[model samples]
Every structure is written in structure tokens, then in C-alpha cells.
Target: MSADPNPHPTEPDVRPHVYDGIREFNNRLPNWWLFTLYATIVFWVGYWAYYEWFRVEPEGARSVELAMTRIDAAKLAATAAVNIDDKSLWAMSRNPVFVDAGRQTFEANCVACHLKSLRGKSESPTAIGPDLTDQIWIHGGDPTDLYRTVTQGVPAKGMPTWGPVLGPKRITEAVAYVLSHHKEGEPIVIDTSVSAPAK
Candidate 1:
């Protein structure tokens, strides 16, 4: 037995346990960190149980299932609300609600391909997508054409169909916006002050 309480002569030991010749130190983690770790583990376990076993929570997370549900819900809502015919969408060109919604949707999703300015990246050798600010559409500039284009997408051209991802409401809004930008002087019938959709 040595005079030193620590068996190892050189190293100042912090932990009780030691392996072969190496000393193990118990650098105790902060209370907040330990608490957070434990809390996260508990939360994960609860989430798994609630989502997987009981199925209590709604499908709000970003997943294929949620997207599909939203699409279906939008379709059903559309069926109940309006006819959504080509003329109707074109008529909504001046509606700020639809135009703004479309713009937001475009900015959120289309910006990656279409660029932030709605203009195609001129610096790039190959164009990722068309310059939306321009009127020259590879597909026709009609509202119905835009709607179909957005719904079905030009997959080969690298445009992913937005119908499933964004739902019909947003697609309709986008169509209206595109048509408004395409041609000049459409009826701006929507009353901005009105709380509900104008009949």
C-alpha cells in the first residue's frame, strides 16, 4: 500500500473508477444539460408512443402523409366552395388575397428554381427554371394552362408538381397570380375589407 490514497502516483484522480492503466474522470455535466437530455429522451419516448401506438396527434409534421392529407382536404374544400373553372380563376386575377398567397407560395417553394427575384439566374450556364417575371412561358400563359402546369408539373424540365405539396387552394392562387402578371387589366373584384369570399 502506498502513502497516497490515489493508487496512481502521477495523475490527480477525479473519478472513482479506473480501467487497465487509464484513469476515468467524472466531469459531472451541468444540471441543465443533464435535465435537458433526460427531458428530451422522455419527450421522444412520449412522442413515439402518442404518434405510433395511440395515434392521438394530428398529422402536422412535414411528411408525405401530411401533404396528401392537405391535398385531399383542399380538394374537398374546393369542391364544396367554388367551381374553380378557368374563367373563375382568371377573374380572380386582381384579388390581392390570391395574388399574395400565390406570391408567398412561389417565394417559398419556387425561389430555389425560379430564383428569389422571380427572374432566372442569369449567371448560371444552364437555366434551372424559367424567369417567372417574363411573359414568355414555355407552356401557354392562360390561367387553365398555368393551373395544369402547376398541378401536373414539367417533371422532365425539373419542375416538381406543386398540387400534392401545396394543395389546390395555393395552386389556384398561384394560377390567378401568374395570369394577372401575364396579361394586363383584369377585374379586381375582391373587396379587401370584406372578411369572407365575395359571392
Candidate 2:
């Protein structure tokens, strides 16, 4: 026979002995999709190398330092600025300027926790701190005791250091306002039902 010059690319070289038509293809993958898959693999490898492998020690040290700093500040706020003398608080309360400052400070900070009435009642369910109106003082009721409590704070009870946060003059004002709870022109009144008599 003469050499077969025409060849059909679609037709397979081997013909099946029996007749049931099924075919196979040796198709190549699309170039764009294959490139995208390779790029994603490269990105994941680079990310793992930089963040997971390289900076572990430095990151750990930074976290530890932050934790220690927070603890120390809590300790200082709980313990500093305490003198434990009653007269000191009393003296501080007597000053009008100090009392006014105290009033302002109390309004700003304490009212949220202690209530505007200063009675320390019905506002907080558990009474996280103490009742200012009542005579029973935990740390002490005297002016000095009050000042110490106000400035240094009782961290165990979640009372923050107003002295550190605010300053001396503001602390004085807070004491004054607390002292004026029963008196006139105070920022908050325990019982507004009874009107104040003419000055």
C-alpha cells in the first residue's frame, strides 16, 4: 500500500476491538489558573517565615513587660498617700476652696459609683465600696482617713487613686463635697424633698 500522508490528530492510534464509543484527552491546564495557585503557596510560606519563625522572643518579652507594669501601678494606687489621722481630713474639709474642688471631683468621678446623692444607697447592688452617709467607716471616717482613701484608693475594692489621677487640689475638693453632704449649696442633695431654709 502507498504511505498514508494524511493523519487525523483527533483519532487515537489504537482502535478497540469491540464497539462502545468512549474517548480520553491529554488536556493541559490553563496558564492563568496555574500561576495563581503557585503565587498563593509562595505567600503562605513567606508569612510563616516572618511572623511565626523570626520574632517570637521579642513579642513574648513585650507582653510580659506590659503585664508587670499594670500590676505595679495597681499596687502603688492601693497603698500610697495614707497617713491615718482624723484631724487631717477634718482640716482639709474646713477649707472652702478645697471643699469646692472636692465637690467638683466627686461629681465627676464618685457619682457614677457612689451616686449623686452621696448616700451610697440603691445605686450599686452589691455596694462595691461603702456608704458615705453612714457613720461606719471601713478604712476610717476622719478627714485624714477620707483623704487617704480618696487619694491612694482601695484597689482591692476597685477604688482608684484620685490623687494620682486628679491631683491635690481636686482631692481636697472631693473631701469637701463629701463633708458637705448634709449642708447647703453642695453639688448633690441627699433629700431634695425638704427645701433649704433661707440663708
Candidate 3:
């Protein structure tokens, strides 16, 4: 048989190994592709250094905590800005918006103890809280007194301090809702002789 033609090609780029009648060639990658690979590596290093090593920015939990703190501060500022008094509370009681918001808050939080009718012991003798609809006030009957009771709470009487829990706006709204059940000029008799309902 005659010698095989072109038994070994002289192309410098071709590798010595062959598989399935195919020869591998060592070619330079496109400039754009090389540039992209290098860019990605550089970007990864920078991102890791900035976020992990250097910690230039606050992490997720810390950022959320900061946001919550700012929100709380803003809420306090807003609460302070409002003129909260007997007259203002009475006015809020008359306002449909305030009353509605108060009702919602009361239903969510106060319904457990006070019951839905705003009459606790009156509605059911087994209720844990006293009647709010009655003219006789256990804590105090004035609008401001009611607001104070809600905010400060009566720990001795098993009431949770709602000021820090509900914030000022929500407490105000809830008090307004309670006040909506009574007339402004109605008689408010203070009866300290009445004991807190047994829980």
C-alpha cells in the first residue's frame, strides 16, 4: 500500500491527541469573552470584600432593626404632636372615623376581656372585666381618666399596660371607641367601693 497522504499535519494549533477521527485545536477565546470572565472575577472579589470582609453596609437584620427603631420614633413624635385631653377625646368619640378605628382596635384587643357589647360584667356575670357602658366608673369616669387607664393600665387589677403595647394612637382610638358609648355631659359617678371582677 502507498504511504498515507498527509499522515501528520504541520498545523501548530492542532493537539497530538485525537478522538473519534477528530483532532482538538487550541484557539484563543474571543476578546469579549475573556474580558467578561475577568470582569466577573473582579466584581465577585469587590462584592465579597465590600459586603462580607469590610462590612461597609448594615446587614439584613441590622437594617430591619434600624428601620423599626425609626418607625417607633416617628410614632412617638406623632403621638406627642396630638393634643390629647378630655375635650379632644370627647371630640374624637363623636368623630365617626376615630370611633370606627377605635371599635376595630377594641374588637381585636379588648374583646377578650371587655366583650363585644362594651358591657363586660353586665353582659355576662362570668366576664373578667367590668362593665364599660355603665355610668358608674371603677377607675375614673372622665374622658382623660379613661385615656389614662387605658394607657397606664391597672396591673393590680390584671390589666396589661397598653401604652407601650398598642402605642399612643391606637390607645387613643380604643379609648375613643369606649367613649362613644357614653354622652359627654352625662353624670360620671366614681365608685371605688366596687371591686375588680375575678379573673
Model 1 clash pairs are: none
> Superposing all C-alpha atoms, what RMSD in Å does each candidate have to the true structure?
15.1, 12.9, 8.0
lDDT by residue (tens digit), candidate 3, 36-66: 9999999999988887899998778998999
Query: Can you give the lDDT of residue 137 in candidate 1?
Result: 56
On TM-score, the stronger of 2 and 3 is: 3
lDDT of each: 0.71, 0.66, 0.89
On lDDT, the candidate that comes out on top is 3
1 against 3, candidate with superior TM-score = 3
Residue 109: error of model 2 in Å?
A: 0.9
The local lDDT score (0 to 100) that residue 96 gets in candidate 2 is 78
Cα deviation at 131, candidate 1, in Å, is 1.7
> Deviation in angstroms for 157 in model 2?
1.1
Give a tens-digit lDDT track for model 2, residues 115-178: 7777665456655445686554567555666778888987666679787788765676677678
Measured with C-alpha atoms, the lDDT of residue 132 in candidate 2 is 84
Query: What would the TM-score be for candidate 2 when compared with the true structure?
Result: 0.44
Worst 10 residues of 3 by lDDT: 4-13
TM-score of 3: 0.61
Ranking by TM-score: 3, 1, 2
